[model samples]
Target: MLFKKTATFITAIMLSFAALFTPFPSHAEAHATNSYQSLENTINAILSDASIKSAMTSVTVRKASTGEIVYEANADRKVTPASTLKLLTAAAALETLGEDYRFTTDVLTDGTISNGVLNGNLYLRGQGDPTLMKKELDQFAATLSKLGVKKINGDLVGDDQWFDNIRLSPSIDKSDETYYYAAQISALTLSPNADYDAGTVIVDAKPTKKGYKPKISVTPDEGIVTIVNKANTVAKGKRNTLSIKRQHGTNKIMVSGNIPVGSSKREWVTVSNPTAHTLAIFKSSLSSKGIKFSSTSKNVRRQAPDTAKVLAVHKSMPLKNLMIPFMKLSNNTHAEILAKTMGKKVYGEGSWNAGLRVMHEYATSIGLDASEWHFEDASGMSHKNKVSSAQLTELLLLVRNAPWYGSFVKSLPISGIDNRFVGGTLRNRLASPSVKGKVIAKTGSLNNVKSLAGYAETKSGETLVFTILTQDHKDSTLPSIDKIATAITTTPIY
Candidate 1:
């Protein structure tokens, strides 16, 4: 089946070349009038702006149906892709796991249940489902209650062996441990809310009495997180500034700042130990359901015993359903989870090294030259990752023929759309009516890197795939990138 599809793709590419070299009468006339040359000059003017003269820029546009290059400028020069790398990860996931793949979280026990007591330890085994919620944990607790297990004689163990023990990527910035974007990745993790942000919690600070310390609270209120508040509420109109940080090697969050009277501040902070946080939340949920544990919960690195019996289970929505949030919000955790999961599924080892190997193999098999791109991490958060505009466009064209292509494209952020989740990272971008809703792409941004890549509908009703990567520019280059997209989307029929 794979070979048959590959042949089809190869044949399509050949046909595109045949058409490009054999121009129609009208196209010949347009060439005589220098239409293509005129467009090239216009695009080159934008790319050569003085502000971005020193930066590395890679741009490529190709006709989706024909696989013919329409425009190119340093397209083969490698540049950091940032979040746009998610496109590669997402495509690999669809191929490896399929659209119907689902993750399951299970409750198991190694002890026998007699009368109203469980004589041994209760194990919570996680399958690395990123969408697990407090409500689902509540359901697990309810199940225990229904089973008449009121007490656990042994420890409440959190089994996170589904993946390796590594939590945060070493390449990520280590100074700010509280930033939710850099949250830890764990097999057993908990997201505070529907944003599906795992390994983090929300901290809200509100003023209490004038000249006194402000009160702090965390949402979903079940996880165990300690907040050391040293903030004060000052007189009205006073400057409001707040600082929130999680101490190294512990789950202690320090919040120090001043908020004017009647003002409130909020932030989403990462948790130091996500396994402990999950266990804490589960234990609390069990307590609310009238269940108790004799000892504190602990992390269990090993797999559950064979003698263990199943108590309750929760399965996540299919992979196809998750693509929307995963891609729309540019969720780093999702990318990492999928990468590790792919590694585990294909090689029986759930590490980044193993997963990235599979990703490279897949990309190469689909016509993207392996030498043209290098990926260090699935989320593109690593500065070591590099890919050329030509490679990204080749990937886009190859995947357009895949069975899951529609869902994959829909997962991208649409340009000019006003909807938050729908518009995603591109919601406010390309707002001009001429371009709005005409382009769908993935966005990438780092300290001084910006990238956008995906599909654009040209005025002639042809679909074009494009990629724009700009790095180390001192000024904003988004406007220039937008103009490039506009040209591709508005390309004349000829």
Candidate 2:
């Protein structure tokens, strides 16, 4: 109900602003009476309108075909791109790695195998593919079982050296530990959150007179170190604090939350170590299927000196499908991994800076003026990032002509109803009758900044590129700022 109320309230505000541009007052004597004559003029007029003028910090619009400027309001100023920065990563990936690219991870056994028993350690290695998950890990284990690997008397080796070592949450504020966003980014993150792994929780609990507590078990895979706590849910519509801790070799997640009487409830909480925990679960599952390991797995420091050689490789979904999730969800992990993977595929090791260098070079080669854009991370999770509206539009323009444009652009979230854009007017309006299927753009937002950049097709089928960036706008003023962006795109021009 709270979420719904918030959504409704925001919608009302947006609609109110949407009504402002319906009919600009034409009778003001000494007003900023700017005639809506040409596309550029109308764009400028709407941008300058008092209703939204205060919220806007900068904006830019351009034609894709001739590289002509259609509108500009502080177009050259620098501002944070937020998640919209994924566009650059995606574009660079398309040009350097192509659309058919894929990320691969492998599992190898180091000790010689005799019959159903392995004489050595089992190795879990990642090839910089960001999509590595539990399901994928499970499949590999299933394969190991078929090879008659009943037991391994050695440690499970986890290797993430395929890419340069990196930690998660380099920029997260420590005070915000309550959020998953605060967790650092890492090449080898095993269940960073002890109780949950990337939103995956194992629920095991039984109902009691006081609450569900006795025999409730929510233990993560053994490889993960756990932290336990006790949470009590008093009533409906509230979350309880369950006892959660990882001591020795176990993570116990006990819940004392309220539930409907006679109700069987289960849910997957976001498990933090998602990557490592996933591998741990896969190993355990494989063990259940006639495979056994007599020793706990250890994080391997370097490549195994004499490890089981890999005979086959399983590639993940094509870059196209993956990028879709990356763009639609604006996943920081996915974007970073893709950038690093692209760099590794081209220059090896997939260093963030290496891939960034490659991306900047490619952007320049494509004739996009990247003079003002500088990136420290592929995913624009940090405020240190900088970009210009013109550069963003130029990126869209470059993506339109690139060979991998189809997958890269198609992956971008549409205006109205994707993961984040659900019921949004600024983006959704692009799918409305006035601009239906005419624009494909990405939106960016920070504390006081909002931006939209992408391509639109004219009624004549010509592609148009535009980018709008508004920084330091007050919260109460965002509605008008959003309206200004919509007005520029949807405001009818004679």
Candidate 1 per-residue lDDT, tens place, 420-481, comes to 56678998998786777677899998888889999887776667778999898888778888
Residue-by-residue lDDT tens digits, candidate 2, 273-386 = 444655566667676676776756453445544546772356767777666656765666666766677778778765776778887887788776667887787777777778
State TM-scores per candidate: 0.91, 0.76
What's the lDDT for residue 361 in model 2? 86
- Badly placed stretches (over 4 Å) of model 1 are 1-35, 295-301, 491-493
Q: lDDT of each prediction vs. the true structure? A: 0.82, 0.58
| Angstrom error at residue 449, model 2 | 2.1
lDDT of 2 at 230: 46
The 10 consecutive residues of candidate 2 with the worst lDDT sum are 24-33
Model 1, TM vs. native: 0.91
